[model samples]
Structures are given as C-alpha cells and as structure tokens.
Target: MVEIKFNGQRYAYWQQVHISASVDDLAASVTLAVTRPGTGQRLGVDANTVIEVLIEGTVVTTIRPDSIRRHVDANSHSIDIEARSLGRELIDCQYSQTLSGLSLDEIVKRLCSTFNVPVQVTAKAAVVPDFSLQCESPANALINAARAANLLLYATPDGGLLLTEPSSAAPVATLVYGEHIESYTVVDEYKLRYSDYLVKGYDYRNDLALKGAVKDSGITFFRPLHIMADKTGQGVGGCDRRATTERNRRQARANRIDLEVVGWTHAGGVWDINSQVRVIIPDEDIDGVYLIGDRAFTLDDQRGSMTRLSVMKREAFLGDPAPGKAKRGAKHKAKSQDERLIYATDLE
Candidate 1:
C-alpha cells in the first residue's frame, strides 16, 4: 500500500497515484489524486507543503508540492497534487563557485549544501585540479563532473543527492514474459546511433591535444559524430573515457526494452532504478541481462497497480570493457532468426 503523510497526518487512501524515478533525472516526481480531505480537516492541500511518501511501510521519498488542483462535482470532490523531491532545488537554482584541487564528491557536497540538500557519495574518484561554476545550475555542474569521473549523480529516494557508479552485482530478479510482465515494447532507434564517435580535447595546462574514437559495429554506414570534451574531461584518459561513454549510452538507448509489470514490489524489495534485471522473452528473442534505467509506480481505476520499467544494456552506465562485442552474440543470433513484432498498445 502507498501512504502520504503531511503535517503529522497519514493518508492511507488515494484515488490515483503515479510516481516516477529515473537514473537520468535528478529528482523523483509524484502525482496524487484523492477524494476527501487527506490533509486532516484542511479544506485543501497547501502549496509547497512537504510530504513524505511511504510504500509497504518503507520510506520512499520526501516531496514538496509544485501544484495543487481541486475539483468538485454534484457528488464528488477531489484534489490532484503534483510534487517533486527536495533535490529539485539543485535543478532549479543557480550557483556560482570556484574551487581547485577537490574531488568530485567534495565539489558535489559543497554545491548541494548551499541548497540544504543532503548528499551521499558512494563511489571514489580522482581529484579535479580545477573546477568553476558561473551562475550555472548545480544539477548540470554535478552531472558533468560525475561524467568526467565516470560516475552518476542522481537524487536518492529520501530527497537527497547520490553520487555513485552503476552496480556490477548480480541481477536483482528475472522478469519473464507471460508471467510477471503485463506488457512489453522493443524500440529500435537508429537516429541516435553513428558509425564513428570522435572525442577531441585540449589540455591547456599541459599544452597537449587529446583524441579518442570508437565505432558502432551495428551502424555499418559512414555516419559520424564529433564531440568536444568539456573542461572536466581535458586529458587523454578523460577523452577516451568520454568517447566510450558516449558510444555505450547511444547504443543502449538506440535499442530499448520497455516493460509493464503487475504490482510494485519484486521478490526482494521495491522496484529500484540503476539496478540490473534479467529479461526472458523467447518470441522477441530478448533473453539477456539489462540495466533498469527508469521506473514508475502507477495506480488508477483501469490499472489497479503496476510498475513501468525501461531497461537498456548493462554497459550503458557501467562503462564496461569494449561494450557488447563479446556478450551480445547469442542474443544477436536469436534476433536475426525472427522478424520483430510491433506492440501497438505500447504506443498509447
């Protein structure tokens, strides 16, 4: 069950609820609709009210409402509330800071503290010689810095920031078609893919030029993409890592698997982002391990309770070695044996 608490009140019932979390975004988003006064005897929920959300007696996120709408009819009264995690402050606020010789975690902690957003660093990274932020969004700065360090920076479920790398552990669970999966979609997008990815940079301090290049074996054509390494990624090693990251991200996204499963909890715990899961769908020939990049817990009259999962190849965020060449053989062979089918319902 889902619970929303505000001003020391617990609202155990809701007409509709949708909560979305993703590795690519810095804040988790929530939309709730309910009849009656969920906020005690109050007529309506106040703007910018701090709310704590819990699922199955476990704290998930603390959110502040960005919008609240009320509706009344002849027999029914309801309110729709939209909220986001406290980490939204980092995305919405501008910050200016200049620091030298600090690690990625230190830079993130400093910026996050300015907005009173708590931070946790789970990965260790090298120190950047210099860093600067000129009235920029802290979210962007943190994201770029983490990318340079080959890490990820996203909002935690508890309304704080987390800096970490993708998990290399075992799959949390296996999702099988016709069992746990309610629906599925396989998307093949070539627009984002390129035959060659070239990353170029210059290290001003060392007066040296750096270059890194990688190819998309699937593209086969002569399409190429050129990228300029940012200030953080200014060295030869940094440029190479950036190039590999770009290619892996594009390839993973170019072919995505979206699934809708019944209920919210897996065997071990609640559905989570940045975790790995094994997928088995014989007809689609998609029997492989994947990374859960996005998750959404949704409930309504039509769909009582369900979770939406968007998964990509594990190498997308892990930055694994030479991504996909050695592991995709069996899956590729199976895919070649059959023509792909269009899941029309997924479009809507």
Candidate 2:
C-alpha cells in the first residue's frame, strides 16, 4: 500500500510532473505529463509505474507486476499498443464487474439506436476521466459517450467531482484537478485598456515614462511606501496580470497594487500581450518573494485602428515640493529669481 507519484500530488489543467509508485510487488518510476481534458495540460507521469488498484471505494487490491501498459513510439513512426495483459490475464474473467445503474451493453445499444454510432465496447476497469458526474441522469446518453473507454473522472479545481465509490482511500474513483496543476502556464491573456478614461493618448505615455523613470531611479526608496492609484494615470487592477516587457518596470508595490471591483476601459483600444508565465521562482537572495518568469511584449488592441494604449517611462521621482519656492508663473507678476526660473520655463 506504499506509493509515490509526484509524491502522490495532483495538479490542475496540464502539469508536467514526475510520479513513481510501488504497489503490491510492482515498482516503477517514469516521466510522463498530466494532460488536460480537451487539448489538456500535459502533466508528467510515469506510465511504467504499477499503481495499486482500488475496487469500489477501497484500496484492497494490489495491481499485479505486469498490470501496466508501457511503450515508446517507434524510432520514427508510431507504435500502437496492442491489447496486452496487465497483472494476470483474465483467462475466464476471474472477477465479474457489474456497473450498477449502468450497463455498457445497454449504453452501446442506445448509442447505436439513437446516434447510429456503434461505440466499440471494450469492457474494462477504470482508466481515465470522461464526464461531468453532477450532470443529471437524463444526460446519460450524451454523457456516457463523452466518457473515456476506461471511465476516469476529472474535476475542476473549484468544482469537486464525485467518485463512483466516495469512500476509497487511494484516489477513489475520482481525481480532483486544480492549481495543483502538473505545471503552471500562461496560455493567453488580454490587457484591458482604460483608454476611455485616458486624459490624452500621448499624454498617457508621457506620464508613464516619467513615473517609470522615477521608479527606476536607483536611489534607495524607503521601505513600504504607500502610493495612491490616483494621479499615477494607472487604472486600479489594470496593472496586475498584463503581459510585461523584459525592460524594467516597477512591480506594483505590495501596498500599491489595487484590486478595485469596478474600473474603466477603452471603448475600442484594447491590448493583448501573449506571453509565457512560469508558476513562481524564488529570488536566491530573498527568502519569501519570487521573481515571476512572465515573458511579455506590447500588442495593440485595435490591430487595424490607428489608436493605441499609451505607455510612458519617467525618471526621477517627483516628490517633495520646493520649500520656499514662489508659486509658479509669479515672476512677471511679483516674484523672485527662483520663481522666474521655475514657473517660466517648461510652463506646460
């Protein structure tokens, strides 16, 4: 009853994981990926392992040593697996398996009766997930068809899947799939533009450049600086998951990253930056924080339109007003030398 599969852990979607197991007298460890349902994530799992088998809802049986299907694609072409024997070949069907509330014969007959599809019946024990169990019995016709020939059920991270035997110890009749993903990935993403709220197209870039420059300035800023989302020209929550470029861009401060429920968007100018994102990688120097490996590039929402979202880079933080400086533009009216220089130059 001892096992080892990614240490017996599950991942969501597709994860490239390593799993090994020793059940009964069989021992195996190989590399294979866990794949998502449809074009599912490719998680790494070893097909060579002889996982212990659980009947009904209990891990009462040990899979015999040869009860596994293992193969490699031919040197160049493909090698289809011929139905080989697993464990001891059932010369006479040692154990009679009856699917209560379900009959493969009836299901196949009904499918042929209704859809004209003669589903080839391969009577076998469970192997892979296939349908949404919570779906009503009325859906059995279309539902069973979606099932894997072996009938292994997979669940979403959020939604739980029920097992045929809800009481088994080993992964019972169901497997819960979620963030425990075999591996993390960034498939696709959209950068929601807040152009409707933009002050000006180019102005946005200018402001961003300035802010970026200020942020990039190497001076040691105090720890835990709380900057409001206002005046920054940055829409709250708009900055969190956008595809980012390799060039330095300040990460939203722990205190500054906003997750506002409601925000603004561009009527037409949207941006989508497709990129690769790794789950998380730790900074050797930093203990708990991780530097994300999210490769990114800028893309226009309005691919054909002339409009584009503005991105600006700024240098030197604009902070702390001059202590005794006169109000801007006061030189001609009434002021001092400093006032003339400060207010008169770059009036815009």
Candidate 3:
C-alpha cells in the first residue's frame, strides 16, 4: 500500500526493512525501485516530503530524501528505482496457533501488544461468508500476477496461500484493498468504491497510536466483508486508469477469464462509462466474458483490488451488485445483520 505515485520519479526507501538479515549479514539495507510512464502530473512527492516504507508486510522505517538518496543517470530505461533499508530491524515471522481460529486482526494484536491501537475497527467478524464453492484462488492468483507482489494475501484456507502462524487470527497491521460501493445496500451493490464516497481510506501511520501496527485487513481491499483502506490511504477511486484495453490488444487471447467495463457511478450521479461492455475473447470461438464466468471484474482503485467471488450465480451477478430475491423470508437472518453492521462500516 505504500506506493510512490509520482511523475517520472525514481525513489528508494531507507525506512522499513522487511527482509531476513543478521548482525553478521553484510548488506545494510533493503531497497525497492519504482518508475512511472512519464506523463501524468505527480504531486504527492517533494524533496522534503518524507514517506513511510513497508517491507514484506512490515513497516521497517522512514527515511528522508537526503538519507534515502537517489541518482538519475543518462538512461531513460530505468523505470524502477530501489528503496533500501537503513538501520532497520531484521524481519522475522513466527507461526502461532489459536483454537479460536486465526485471522489478520489477531496477528496485529500480538505484534503490537504494547501499544493502544488507534484503529477504528469499523467492524469485525470472526466469520467469513461460506462462499459455497470457495474464495476464488484464480482471483488471488490473478492478483499475484497483476500486482508485482502478493500485496494482499488470500487467507480463506483455499490451500493456495500460506496461512499465518497458528495464533488463529487475521492481520493485525495490514493495507486492505477494496471497493466502496454505495448506490444500493444489496450484496450485488457491494462494489462501493472510495470514488463513490462509499469507501473510506485511512493512513493509520499518521496516528501515533496505530504506528508500526497492522491496523486491520478491513482497510485492505479484499472481500465484500474485509477492508483496510483506513490504514494506508490505499482507497481505490473511480477515476483509475484501466489496463485491460492494452492487455486485450495483444495476440490470440481468449477464453479462461473475461474482462469488461460495465457501469460506474460518476460525478454527482451514476452512469455507465461505456455503452456496451460485453464479455468477449478474440480469435477463439469463445466470446463475451466467457473466461471468468462472465461475472468477475476488478475496480480501478489500486488499494482495493481483490474482488472476492460472489455466492450468487453468474447470471445473478450480471447487471450489478443489487440483490434479487427479497431475503426477509428466504434464508439466514441476512437482512437484520446487514441493517446492523452496514451502517457501522461499509455502508456510505
């Protein structure tokens, strides 16, 4: 979640070292190289503006522009720069177990037990939606390939990800990613993104109480239930630049998963960005969102990218996040729970 969205900028963080090393280790720092496409106007960075750096799910340290240091040679090809750690702590993780079942929340509590957490648990639930099939692995796998790293860890016991120690808890300090949908209160309407004012992003590092602590995966963009935008200002907005177009232009790509631009809420209102966003793959006989079952699609907000699979069938997920049947008499006490918790957090 700690990204440097600057124009033609190359930065190396001297703060926050999340790598394995020892007093006997020779290297003094860990670094990251970042480069942009050179066109947009970058504003959040400055020569004196110092930002925090997070390494391997850990916040190592913060360094100044001078201390971090930077050099731009005659080569225009260096799209990425490296951010190295200074006098940071050696990073290590231990496996802990909890009979209550572990999750991100438990992880942070154990890590920062000494501090009073500044995080506003907008809401917490030991339960995750059953997801009849399973929380999609291809989805998280797609993300792993999409974003250079597994920035958002998938923890649904899908046999895909490495679950944290047995401590039986979710992330205590995390950069959650998710949409902030707000037009409707239905499950299908859950794409509420920060751009729609349906989602809220917070930078917990600014709060002394939450410093160096994994606030909550709720802030991180994941399923319709979890979020962590509040911890790292990683809220995804509506105005994000989509890459599917470029990705589509390439050779013989079809089948598997489909991608499309359906509709989006905009300016003082809601509207569709494209008139006809059909699911289609090229060359192969298959077309029209055939790969991802014509249902899964990602929002533009960088912070919230993991769009957890909806229990609703592909056809049900067609139009939008709006629910179909009236649930008052159908099944679980969903209506009452929605009324109770939606107001507390995800609800706009």
* Top-scoring candidate (lDDT): 1
The TM-scores of all predictions, comma-separated, are: 0.85, 0.15, 0.21
Tens-place lDDT digits, model 3, residues 178-215: 22221111122223221111222222223111111112
RMSD of each: 10.7, 26.9, 21.2
For candidate 1, write residues 107-201 as lDDT tens digits. 77887888888789898777766666666676766665566556777778778888888877789999999998989999889898999987655
Q: Report lDDT (CA) for all predictions.
A: 0.74, 0.20, 0.22
Lowest lDDT 10-mer window, candidate 2? 339-348
Q: What TM-score would candidate 1 get against the native? A: 0.85
What's model 2's overall lDDT?
Answer: 0.20
Q: Which candidate is the best by TM-score?
A: 1
Who is ahead in lDDT, 1 or 2?
A: 1
After superposition, the stretches of candidate 1 with alpha carbons farther than 4 Å from their true spots are 36-48, 235-237, 320-348
Pick by lDDT: 2 or 3, better one: 3
The better candidate by TM-score, 1 or 2, is 1
303-324, model 2: which lDDT tens digit per residue? 2111111111111011111111
Residue 234, model 1: lDDT of 39
Q: In model 2, where do residues sit more than 4 Å from their true spots?
A: 1-215, 219-348
